[model samples]
Target: MKSTGFTLETLKAKVQALTRPERFVHILRVAELAQAIAEANGLDAQRAYLAALLHDAARDLPEEELLRLAPPENDVERSHPLAVHGRAARRLAEAWGVTDAEVLDAIEGHVYGVTPDNRIGMAVYVADVSEPGRGVNAEIRELALAGRLEEAYRQAIVSKVTYLKGKGVPVHPRTLLAYDAVLA
Candidate 1:
């Protein structure tokens, strides 16, 4: 699907300029992983890569700026201001001439979680959590590489919830809903 007027290289440059050096590298890794997962799952690899590449465009934005760009829609999002970056990123992608619905949906849902109908969003979400650069265990990566995307996504969500609980951090309600939806 057509997403943006800019080429991948141009978009990469823009993302690099927008994020920290380390975050830029992580974005690249996520894109690589997303593309691999898409290929394995018979989805559009290019679209997955593009969505992953722009997924974190607003990740490093100041809290005030992020909130200004996209206000939190719930108590979970309000408590976890960074979670709103997904919405902000979607806005940024649109501003950059990305009009593809799938790509925008993926970007908007990469952080919190999307509806169960959004397979592209699930691919990006799982890739973001399981990319090599993130130090995710090999088993999770293998699951994605093996085309078991739903399993991998479910695992990632479980792990995230467990980690947050262990650290005494509040779990986002959307994450719990996603976990349930994926299980269903």
Candidate 2:
């Protein structure tokens, strides 16, 4: 479990303490899915699992605390403060001794959107949305497992946007940018 002075068990304990039981289960599922996607795509499965495990580390924090940890970067993030968990997660991961830049970047971008250049980040992002517990799209999970990462990620984002629109919620700009980047 020890890797570069960080223990997987230690990180899991920290995550369990930070999240509720349900959220902790969700985190584990995301990690599992991320690992599968990473392995299928020839990426680092361990890094992907670590990133997914820590991606929601700060999600249940108080709104004030999340804002304090990482100030919102845009109007959407400011209005929906929970979205900033991704950004705040980077700090938590770093404090937990997760020094890999790829892992941190994946955790930081999992909630909002990852840059196209970060394959690990993309895997984490896709896995978070398509995790089985979400009970939404099954095709995204299939695409990810099949190694069609970009396609899976695009479908996940599109499904999210569509759902938001149906709910009369404004889509976050970062998501739109992510969708565009994937297609470009």
lDDT, residue 85, model 2: 91
Task: Give the lowest summed-lDDT range of ten residues in model 2.
Answer: 1-10
lDDT of 2 by residue, 57-161 (tens): 999999999999999888888888988898898998887787888788889888767777788998999999889999966789899899899888888877877
Which parts of model 1 have CA positions greater than 4 angstroms off?
none
Q: Give candidate 2's error at residue 48 in angstroms.
A: 0.4
lDDT of 1 by residue, 5-119 (tens): 8888888988899899999999999999899999999889989999999999999999998999899888878888998999999998898889999889999988877776777
In the predicted model 2, the residue pairs found to clash are none
Superposed by TM-score, candidate 1 places the C-alpha of residue 129 at a distance from the truth, in angstroms, of 0.7
Candidate 2: C-alpha lDDT: 0.87
